[model samples]
Target: MSSWQIGDITVHRIDEIPLPPETGAWLLPGATPEVVARADWLGPSFAGPGGELHLAVHSFAVEIAGERVLVDTGIGNGKTRANPAWHDLDTDYPARLAAAGFAPERVDRVLLTHLHADHVGWNTTRAADGSWRPTFPNARYLTARAEDAHWAQGELEPSRRQMLDDSVEPIRAHGLLDLVDVAEGGTELLPGLTLVPTPGHTPGQFAVVLSSGGRSAVITGDCVHHPVQLSDPALGSCVDVDPAAAVRTRTGLLERLAGTDTLLLGSHFPAPTAGVVRRHGEGYRLEPVPSA
Candidate 1:
C-alpha cells in the first residue's frame, strides 16, 4: 500500500487497475509526444521509457479520527462498462482493500468527487444472484447534488447512464446517499477535511482539502489527471465535458497551489501520485514526494 501522512490523517492508495503506458497524444488531444517530452520531471514514474504516460484507476483510503473514508471507488470487479478498457474488470479490489487493513464493512463514507463512471464503479458490486448491491453496506455515499441533477436531465451517453443504473442508483436505493451543493465552495466532510469546488471537468466536480498540524493536502479528483497537463494547462483530456472551462479551473487551481506546502493527491495519476505543484517556465511541474 502507498501511504502518506498529512497531519493527523493517514491516506492509503488501494489500486483496482493500472493503465499501461500510452503516448501522450492518445490520452490528451493536444498532448503530442513532443509537447510532453519537454517535461523532464515525469520520467520513470509518471512517464515511461518512450514518453509513454502512465495512469491508474484507484481509490484512496483516508483514515482520520476513527473514520475510514474512501475518497473514490475505483472500477469494480465483474461489471459491464461502455469503455472497453473498463468493461468486465475482474481485479481483486476488495481483497486488496483487506490487505491494506480495511474491510468493506469497516468503511464509514464513500465520497465521490463527481458521478463519473470510473469514480463510482465500486459503489456497488454484482451479487451471485445476478443483482447489483452496495459494496459497502455499512457506509454512506456522498456526492454533489448537481451531479445527480445533471444525469437527471438525460444529457449523458448510454454508457454513462448504464453506469448510473448499476453503480450509482443502487446506493440511492439503499438509502445511503448524501448529495451536497458544491457551487460556492463545499461542505465540511470532517472537522479538518473540506470539499472545495473545482468544477469544469464535471458540472459539480470538487476536491478534498485536508488541514491539520499546520500541514495540508488536496485530493484533486479529476481536476487534473496527469502530470503532463501541468506542463501545459491548456491541454485537456478527450473525456473532458467542457474543455475550455476545465482549463480555467485547472490553471486557477495551479495558481493557488503552486509553491504551497499543500500536497496534491492526483486521483488517476500513476504511482507516487502525491506531489507538490511548482511553477515552472511558463507553466508548472509536479515534484513527487519520495514514497515510503
Candidate 2:
C-alpha cells in the first residue's frame, strides 16, 4: 500500500490500474522517445528504459481533520469513454478504495480537479436497473463552478455528453454535486483541504492543497500530468483546452514550488508519486520522496 503522511493527515493511494505506454504517447506527443532519453534524471522511476512514461490511475483516500475525503476518482468501471484505454474498464477500484478505508458511502467529500472523463468516471456507478447513480451517495461531490459553466455555455461532442450523462449528470440530478467557486487564491473546503484554482487543462481545473501543522502537499490535478512538465512547462498535453494558458499555469506553479519542501504529488505519476521540486538546469525536477 502506497501511503504518505503530512502532519496529522494520512493519504492513501487507492490503486485502480497502471496506464499503458500508449497512454503516455497519445496524451503527451511532445515528450517523444528522443526527448525523454535526453532527460537522464527521468529514468528508473518516471520513465522506462524504452523512454515510455510511467503513469497510473488511482485515487488518494485522505483522512483529514474529521473528514474521509477522496481525491480524483480514476477511470471507473463500466465507463464508455472516447479514449480506447478508458473505455469499459472493469477494475476493482471500489474495493481498493474500501481497503484504503474510503468506502463509497463513507466518503465525506469527492474533490474533482476537473470534469475530464478520467477524473469524473467514478462519480457514479451503473445500477442493476442500468441507470448510473451517484457512487458516494453520502458524500458531496465538488468541482470548480467554472467547469460546469464552461460546458453549459457550449455544446459538448457526443462522447463528451455521454461521459457527463453517465458520471456527472447523475450526481447533479441526485443533488450530491456541489459547484464551489475557487477564487484566485483558493477556497478551503475543510480544515486542511483547499481548492487552488488551476485552469487551462480545463477552464476551471483546480489542484487540491492539503495542509496541516507546518507541512504542505499539493495534488497536481491535470495542470501537470507528468513529471516531464517539470522539465518544461511548455510541454503540454494534446487535450489541453488552452495550450498557452496551461503553460503559464504550470510554469508559475513550478517556479514557486522549486527549492521548497512542499510535497508535489502527481495525480498520474507512477511510483514514488510524491516529491519536492528542485531547480535543474533551466526548468525543474522532482526530488522523489517515497511513500510509506
Candidate 3:
C-alpha cells in the first residue's frame, strides 16, 4: 500500500495482477546475476530454465481538489488479452476502489500513459451482454493522438494490434476518448497535472507530472522501467519501438528528473512508488520514500 500527498492531491497505488515467469523474463533478461546479488531485495525477480521472468502489475489513482483521476488501469478483470494470465473479466476492482475511499462512478478522468494491455486493462469493464465497456462511464479517457494513429496503422506486430483493440478502441467507441497532442514538451491536462512527452517506448508515450505548492511528482510510465535501465540508458526493453530514440529520451529524462526534487512514481517499481532520482557514478539511483 503506497500513498503520498502533494499539496491538495493524494496518490494511491492499487495492484491488480502479477506477471508470470515468461513474461517477466521478457522484461529483464540478465536476471540470474541481479537476482542472486539482490536476493533479499528482489521482490519477484527471477528466471527459469526456459528463461522466463516474473513481473507485477500496479494501477495508480490521483485525487485532487476532490476530483478522482485514475492513471494506468492495471490488467483488468476478464480482459481477452493475448496473455493467458490477463484473461478473466471477474474481479472486485470496484470494491477495491471503494475500500480505498473511492467509487468507480466518482472517477473524473482516466489517463493512460500508453495503450499497453496491462496499462489500459481497466479502462473498460465487462458488460452484462459480455461486451467490454468503459469502466469509468463519466470520466474522459485521455491518450496521445500520435500513439492512437501509430498503433491503428495496421502495420504493427499482430499481438500489439490485439492489445490496442481491447485496451484503446472501447474507450474511443464510447465517445470518451480524448486524443490529445503531446508534442510541446508537456500539456496541462488537469489543474495541477500535466502530460510530458517522453516518447520512444511508443511513438507518443508521455509521463504525467503533478505540480502543487512548488513541489512536483512525475508518474514515469515506461520511460524508465527498471532501476538498472538508469545505469544503462542504452539498454532498452525488447518491446521498444525505437531503441536508439528510447535511450536518448531516457538519458535526458533522467537528467531532468534528477535535477529536481520531484517525487518519482514508477508504474512498475516495487510498492510505495514514491522516489527521487540522484546522480550515481555514471548513472543514477532512485531514492524511495522511507517505509513506515
Best by TM-score: 2
Stretches of model 1 off by over 4 angstroms after superposition: none
What's the lDDT for candidate 2? 0.89
Model 3, stretches more than 4 Å misplaced? Answer: 30-54, 156-158
Over 95-119, each residue of candidate 1 has an lDDT whose tens digit, in order, gives: 9898877799999998999988789
Cα deviation at 148, candidate 3, in Å, is 0.5
Residue-wise lDDT of candidate 2 within 1-292, one digit each (tens)? 6999999999998888888888898899999988888777898899989989999877888999899999988888888877878889988888888888888889999999999888888998999999998899999999889998987776889999998888888999999889989999989889988999989999999999899989999999989999988887899999999999999999999998999899998899888888999999888989999997
In the range 1-292, model 3's lDDT, one tens digit per residue, is 5678777788887767556556555665544445424332223332233433334678778887668888898888766666777776566777777677657888898888888877988887768997778888889889899888877775777766766677678888889999999866689877899999888888888999998888888888988776656555676787888878888888998888885788888787655456788876667766667422
TM-score of 3: 0.88
> lDDT (0-100) at residue 173 of candidate 2?
91
TM-score of each candidate structure, all chains considered together? 0.96, 0.98, 0.88
Q: Rank by lDDT, descending?
A: 2, 1, 3
In angstroms, the error of model 1 at 66 is 1.9
Q: Which lDDT values do the candidates have, in the order given?
A: 0.86, 0.89, 0.75
Clashing pairs in 3: 21-53, 24-53, 24-54, 25-53, 77-89, 78-88, 78-89
